[model samples]
Target: MQLQILEVILWPKAAGLPPRRVPFEPGKVNVISGASKRGKSSVIPIVDYCLGSRLCAIPAGTIREACAWFGIRVQTSEGEKIFARREPGKQQSTDEMMLLEDSVLDVPTDTPKKNTTRQAVKHLLDRLAGLSNLGFDPEEPRSGFQGRPSFRDTLAFCFQPQNIVANPDVLYFRADTNEHREKVRTIFPYVLGATTAERLAKKWELENLLRELRRKERERAAHDTVSATWLANLQVWVTEARELGLLRGDALEATEETLIVALEKVLAAGEEGNGFSAQGTGASADEYAALQTEESKIVLDLSVARHRLNQITAVRGTVGYYKGALDSQAARLGVSRWLRTLSNDGARCPICDSAMTSSSGELEQLCDALATIENETHTVSMAPPVLDRDLVDVKSKLSLLEDQLKAVRIRKRAIESRSKAIREGEQTSARVARFLGRVEQALELFSARSAPGGLNEELEKLNDSIEDLRKSLSEQQYALKLDAATARVSKDITRIAAKLDVERKDAPARLDIKELTVGVRDDAGREDFLWHLGSGANWLSYHVAAILALHVFFLRQLHSPVPALIIFDQPSQVYFPQRLTRPTAQSEEDDIGDEDVASIRRFFEAMGKLAAHFKGKLQIIVLDHAGPDVWDQLEAVSLAEEWRGNDYLVPKDWLDILE
Candidate 1:
């Protein structure tokens, strides 16, 4: 797809400063190169922010504060469109953006805010760029990204920020984050026409199905761990109930439902009293009532005796505790007496390690406390024997009550035994019926705990389905297509690298498609990849060539969804320092050497050749500190005046504008 930025406009918040507009033409390398801090690097972020970047990456200073809105005019297959995003406020940028379907030649004095959201603009861009809305599930929960590929995802290849342009470890913008790197990897094959939208969707669906299947299998395994014990208990209960004739079935062969039915039958038999007679040899009602009354009186007497015994036992324990405490107190009193004697003889205080004197009053008080403890201990010792006597009496009373209660209960049980025989036989059906109800509930719970028999079968079917889809995907020849595309991109990179005269032995032959990198064969014959190339010049050259090659590959494919625009922010940094005030003259001490100058010239020459090769389809924008002299021989436009003196991408006058 063809996509080019026609112009980038920064609207002033106040009327005093006019809008700043940087214009561009198609089929040429547009260089916004000048001195440092002249808003040369800000262009990439401004255009990216207008293109629906989540955060407003524009620096938070005079330029951002002065601008009310950031806008970009782009030419796509859907014709010219202008997108404007309001400058983020102190709090945050609003989701809303302004969009004009037609060409925007000049900044509008009164552009009205519209209800179009950032998401809507993204969707529109996706459509205009011919990107398929291919949906997919995240590899795991809370991965922070899901759904279809967006136009913003494609920008990883198109835009190179200053931090990444010369960074060897990074290949794409914002790829510093793992998630962004994953997104780039996932969309790389699709963006290059190596895989179809349908195939990608199916692959994601199969992956989700497999994840679900594994989750269900884990649940089944967990259930099995607990269900074994439940099943064992169920079998034991079934056997016991069967032996008691509460369940009338062969428990071994019975299903849960059958066991439930047998249990119900047993309960019904209990309710009907199927095997008992009403008449039996038992005591009369008068005798039984007289025994019950006698048992009640004995029980009350036994309870009173036990309560008194408990109180005596508690008193004995307290007396023993007090006796031990009194003994300890006596020993302490002896120690105090010794200390007092020592103090009177001019001894040091043991506690404070100072000269001490024992007062007569204090000694007397200690003597009184010791005497009291002695008296209390003597009294407590006397009480224990009394408590023992009381305990003896209570125990005697308790023994008599137990004997009476036992005699009565024995007689009562003899009478109850005859009656119970008759009642139990008569009520067997009812008892069994209740037991059956309980067993039925237990069986239901057991069945619930058991894993569903179809779970494994269903999982197998899913696996089979996934396998079939995999086979179908394989039949689509993704690997072959990807290999072919990689070869083409590698060839293009080799050609571009050679044209730039990058110093590397066998650079073309060392391009590894699987690794997505180019290597340099050293004197030791060891291959060093782009990330390990050390020098900033080699890093910058490799990135420029690789990125341009991928774009070239995309342009050659009729159905590739990537846009035909490349934005490079400071590709000249490898040749000059970041803090360079301006382009240096030939005689300057810090001037770029001839070799570096020729490399920069060749870089622009390669860009021009690629632009012409694509027949006015590709757009290249370079934001750097290079002068017009470096690019004057090539068909490149230099926005040098825009960065001259106080003028910048956002004009100096605009900095004074405030809302």
Candidate 2:
């Protein structure tokens, strides 16, 4: 991460006046030496505000009033990036920002518009620093800080402000507050190479696996929870499958395992086309309708045939009856023929041979009347020849009709019987279908519960994975490496402190993670906190030592996420509280006293040593009131800005608009 500040740009509020650009060089101690009220201390906050800080803490006076937009150009691995933020007025901060990126960036001659947001810039910066995209809390970033490390979190090591430069209570820049302290603590191991990116990723994986393990374990437990009830239902299901003919060889064993096998067999039977689906009555609606219609037509045809037969038989029987009556009369009238013969014998009784003439005439008359009656009765044709022929045709038709009617009656009975059977079979089929459906449902449930690749297997796998990840990600797992990293940083701190020669410089100095401050331990391992072991000079030197040591360690790591740039604002403030006029050839800092001059010299020298150690891999920016005489002999230092009478972060000409 080589995000070295190229320049701090302040576009003036007055129209048509070009922005003032304060240029800084890379990988060197770029110093901004100026007097008090020259906007030297404001440089840190101005740079922070431009780099996406939420607060506009750029000294709400001349610097804030004179500048319309605050911007910083920094060099990153992706080349130069310009991050400019509009000054927040009557507000803590604004999200409005403008971000520009290219291989080479120049300070804009005209004021740029807010083309992006502070959050967008922060993400760009985070990625530039090799920070992970998973840095934000899923629920809320402000909730617990389990999120990935942010670019701002690393800034706690990057900036050492005036108030923070000598504050022994806090080692990291923003560790004074709880929110910042915890965030820095969380990310320190990552920046120090103790916790690798692989470890963080594995930690996340472990949490997910643990959640999955819990859920699967619950499901496996649920299977146990309902095992007995399901077994009871399984027995019932097996019995149904057999009764529905979905299963074969039907005596139910009713044991749980056997019932499961039975269900599987039933499903197999369904697949083999022997299921209850094949147990239908095989009755068709069209067949039923056709049979019913034929039955009705046959019944009607039978009724018509019977009626025609009755009519023809009645006519024939009547003719025969009349003829028979006539025949009987004619037979009885045969006595008339005998009477006629008797009349012809002279009206004498058949029993007497002789008769009188008068008696014979009277008998003859009676005989004639009787004979006429016999003749008329005997001559009446019971059936004429034509009628007889018609009757014969009628009898033939009647015989044929009787045969047809008999056949129709037989067919109608058959249809009715078949229809009755179909209706009964359909009723039975409906019941069987419904029972089969229930059996299918029960079998599904049974198979799911008794499945082979069950929840227990998945749960076991998840537990195994969780155990592995837990081991890999545990803090104790990285304890030795972390301790080694801390030890190295502490050793550097002790060496750097020795040069500055602060109190307890000979003692072992260590960064107390829990205390979040530097601790110097004497023999018994008891120590004075940096806050307690302090004069102003002591606090300042220790602060510088701790910060520079951390940076050295950061540069040593192959893939440290901390920005390679560290900015110290007004580091010479404790030494030169009033100010130092830029020295000329005749006079070099006439204001300097013997009081702690060597300490300040050693202070810059330790910084110069680290700068020389990691030449091109690191950048150090100092905004101070120290003159050229104070740090000119050091070749590692570069002059970034030399603020004089009216020139500052905000020029005097830029402030005329506010006045």
- Candidate 2 wrongly placed segments (more than 4 Å): 135-144, 230-450, 579-593
lDDT of 1: 0.70
lDDT of 2 by residue, 337-391 (tens): 5666666666666577566454656656656666565444323331232133233
TM-score of each: 0.60, 0.69
Error of 2 at 392 (Å): 99
On a 0 to 100 scale, what is the lDDT of residue 64 in model 1? 80
Clashing pairs in 1: 267-432, 267-433, 269-429, 270-428, 270-429, 270-430, 271-429, 271-430, 276-425
Question: Cα deviation in Å at residue 159, candidate 1?
Answer: 2.0
TM-score of 2: 0.69
Give residue 252's error in model 1 in angstroms: 10
Residue-level lDDT of model 1, residues 1-659, one tens digit each, is 66798888888777655567788987677877677777777888888898999988888887787788888888875568888988878855667798888644445766437658899998787765555444444365234455567789889889988999878777788878877877777677777777665565556556656766787678668767767775455566677677676565343554655545555455445444333342333334667899988888888888888988898888879878989989899878966666667777888877888765636568767877886776566445545533433554575577557657856976776556434434444544555445554554555334543446345665677689778978887955888888777778878777777776567634553445445456666777787787877788778888888899888888766445677899998887777544333445546555654667777878888887788777678899988777776767675444524376766776655554342
